[model samples]
Target: MPFKKYLLTGLMVWLPLAITIWVLLWLVGALDAVFGGLLSVINSVAPVAITVWSEKLRNIPGLGVVLVVSVMLVTGALVSNVAGRWWIRQWDRLFTNIPIVKSIYNSVKKVSDTLFSSNGNAFRTALLVQYPRAGSWTIAFQTGVPGGEVQNHLGADFVSVYVPTTPNPTSGFFLMLPRSDVIELQMSVDEALTYVISMGSVAPSLPAATLQKPKP
Candidate 1:
């Protein structure tokens, strides 16, 4: 029994580290594969000396990630100028003129802009709400209020919230509830996410003001 307990404890300590390393290795392999494919295409029509060098470059570990990052940095720098803006507008126009591609591209672009823009309000606040049934509470995030015809029907007192599932936060339910029913939390969005993803095993500490005892 003692040996079994010890083995279980050791596994608890090492499991998280093992999974983290495995995920990182997978990401590196995927990036390397992209670069390898590009080199393979180039090798088809190039001189023998050039093809040899491309193959050698593909074998270098982490080079693909480095090259991709460098390209992003250079692209960002270029896009910060006036001419770059003009070109980007032209690029968007070209894409937007396409039939099927425009619909997909525009939908994705709108979602990305809302999620990643500096001034966007999505996921900015954490809330405590009763979900699935009354008297049962869960952590949720404010993703913005209802819009368009839904807003017209729901009125001004409703908000949109996302409740993420435990252990895997990617998939979740979206609820539009009355603002009065949701209690705003002092904890940050990141803290709330950690709590939810840990299945309430981890909780954010109370704010300093909440910790102070009231004078009798």
Candidate 2:
């Protein structure tokens, strides 16, 4: 029993590290595949001296990730300019003219903008809400305050909460609960996500003040 316990303990220690390494390797491979094609095209069109160096660069593992990061930085810098904004708008307009591609591109672009923008309001806080039934609570992310038609219909102060499912945080239910019903927590979005993904096995530590009863 002791030996078996020791083996299981060892596995627990190594399994997470192994999976992390595997995921990282797979990501690098995927990036290499995407950038590899562009690199090949560049090499073909480049001068003989540059082409020789590019061919060597192409063989180096993880070079694609570096190039991709550099490209993203340069693209971000360019897009921050007025001329670049005009060019991007024109390019976006071209995509918007396409029927099927327009819908998909616009939806994805909106989501990406909301999630990545520094001023965006999505997932700003964690909350404890009674979901599915009363007296049963779950961890939820505060997406934002309700607005538009939904807000007008509700006619009350309501907060938009996203209750993510166990193991897969991407898919979840969006609920609009009265502000009073939701308990705001000091724990961060990342900490709440870890607690959810671990299915309550991983608990986040709370401050003593949070645990203390409020003054009467």
- The numbered model that scores best in TM-score is 1
lDDT for position 54 in model 1: 99
On lDDT, the leading prediction is 1
lDDT of each residue in 58-128, candidate 2, tens digit only: 79999888888999999989999999999999999999999999999999998788777789778988999
Worst 10 residues of 2 by lDDT: 207-216
Looking at model 1, the pairs that clash are none
Q: In candidate 1, where is summed lDDT lowest over 10 consecutive residues? A: 207-216
- For candidate 1, the TM-score is 0.88
Which lDDT tens digits does candidate 1 get at residues 1-216?
999999999998998899999998888889899999999999998999999999899889988888888998988898899998899889899999999999999999988888888898889899999998999999988888999999999899999999988888889999999999999999999899989877888889989898896867
lDDT by candidate, in order shown:
0.92, 0.90
